[model samples]
Target: MSVIIKAAPLELMIIGGAALGAYIIANPMKVIKAGFKMSIKAMTAKGPQKQDYVELLQMMFQLFQAFRKEGPQGIEKHIEEPDKSDIFKAYPSFMHNHHAVHFLCDTMKITLSAEMSPYDVDDLLDADIKAIHHEEHMAVHAVQTVADGFPGLGIVAAVLGIVKTMAHLTDGVEKIGALVASALVGTMLGVFGAYGLIGPTATKMGADIDAEGRYLGCIKAAMVALQRGAPPIVCVEYARRSIMPEERPSFEEVDKATKEIKKAA
Candidate 1:
C-alpha cells in the first residue's frame, strides 16, 4: 500500500483533488451535509428494524384508541402538542424521528378538523411522502454521480502518470518501469474506489432512504384507514401490512399488542 502511494502520489492528488472539486461544485451545502449524514446512517443502521416497526404500530394503535374512546376533542391534546403528550413520549424512538412525528400530527390535525375525504387524505399523504424523500433522493444521486465519474477519473490519473513518464525518457529502463507501474496503480485505484467503495455506499444509502420512506408509508396507511372509520385494530393492521414482510408483525402479535394496550388503558 505504501509502495503504491509512493509511486502514485501525484496521480492520487490529481484524481482525489478533481473528485472533491466536482463533488463540491455539484452539490449545495444542504445536499453535501445530507450525503454525509445518510452515509453514516447507512453504515450504522440496517434501516427500520423489526422492533422499530412493531413499536410504530403500537404507538399508532394507542393514538387511535385515544381518539375512539374520548372522541376527537379528547385526543386533541396529544396531537396538538405531541412533545408534551405522554402517549408520544412513551415511544422515545418514534418521538426522536421528527418526520414521523410531524406526519402523524399533521395528518391527525386535518382529520380532527373533519375537512377532507379519506381518499383525499390518502393522496395528500402520498404527496407529502414523495416531497420528503425527494431531498434524500438527491443526496443519494449526488453520491452515485461521484461513483460514476471515478473510473473516468482513474483514466485521467493514468494519463497524467504517462505524461510525467514521457518527460523522463532519458531515465534508465528500471526507472521507466517504475513510472509505468505507478500509472497503472492510478487506474486500479479509480476503478476499485468506484466499484468497491463509493458505488456500494451509494446503493446502501438508497436502500436506507427507501426503508425510511416505507416506515412513513405505514403511518400513512394507518392514518388513511382511520379516516375511513376503520376500528383501531383494522387501522393498525393496515399499517402493519404496509411494513415489509420480514419486518411486519404477525396478525396474532398485533392482536395481542392491542389487547395489552386496552388492558393498560
Candidate 2:
C-alpha cells in the first residue's frame, strides 16, 4: 500500500505552530530551554543509568571517609572547589553532574559546620530535594499541557479543512470526497501527535525527573545517616539501599570498592 497524504503538512503546521506558540506563552525562556534539553536527553537516556548511580555511591563513600579521617578542614577543599579537587576528579561521571556535585558539596558544607542536628539535616535535605523536583516538574507540566491540547488542535484543523472543502462543492462528489478525506487527516495528525509522540515524551520526562530526585534522596539518606554518627561505610550503605533495586549495587560490590578506596587512601 502506497502511503502519502498531501494535505498532512498544512494541517500539521496549523496544529503544531499554534501548540508551539501556546507553549512559549505558557512557560518562561528557562523552562523552554530546559524542555528542549530534557527532550533531547530523554531520547538517549532514561534518567540516571546503573553506572552513574554506582559512581555516585562510590563518590559519596569516599567523601565520607575523607571527612572521617581528616575532619572538616581536610574535607573543606574538596567540597568548596570540587572542580579542582582530586577526589571529585577520580569520578568523572559523578563530577560531570553539576546537580550531584552541588548537592553533595552543599550538604557537606552544612554538615561540617557542626550546627544542625541529625533531624535538622534530614529536614534541610528533604526541603532541597522537594524544591529541586518542583522546578523540574514545571518543564514536564509544560510538555504535558501541549499534549493535552493536541486533540483540540487537531479538531480545529479538521474544521478548517471542512470549510475549504465547502467552497469546492461544485467540483463533483469524487472531488468533494477527496477534500473531506484531506480534512480528516488533520484530526488524525493531531491525535497521533498528542498520544503517539508528545504524551509519551511528557510521561518519560516526568519519570526522569522522579529518578533524579531519587538519586538526590539517596544522598540525603546517607548524609542523615552520617550525621547520626554512623560509620562511613555504613552511611554509604544506607545511601545505597535507598537507590532503586535495579540501580542499587550489590553489597559485596560496594564493600569491595570501599575497601579499595581505603587502600588507595
TM-score per prediction, in order, is 0.93, 0.95
For every candidate, C-alpha RMSD to the true structure in Å: 1.7, 1.5
Error of 2 at 157 (Å): 0.8
Give the clashing residue pairs of candidate 2, or none. Answer: none
Best by TM-score: 2
Question: For residues 1-265, what per-residue lDDT tens digits would candidate 1 score against the true structure?
Answer: 7659795667768777898889989999999999988888878878778888878888999989888999988789999999999999988879988899999999999877768888999999999999989999999999999989988999999888899899888998988988888998889888988999889999999998788899999999998899899999899999998888988889888888788888999
Candidate 1 ranges beyond 4 A from true positions? 8-10
- What clash count goes with each model? 0, 0
Global lDDT of each model? 0.89, 0.87
Best by lDDT: 1
Task: Report the lDDT tens digits of candidate 2 across residue range 1-265.
Answer: 0112588789889999999999999999989988888877767786777777777778888888888889898889999999999889999987777887898899989777768888999999888988888887899899999999999999999999899999999999998988888888888888999999999998999888888888888889999999999998899889988988988889988888888888898
Q: What is the lDDT of residue 207 in candidate 2?
A: 89
Q: How high a TM-score does candidate 1 get?
A: 0.93
> For candidate 2, what is the TM-score?
0.95
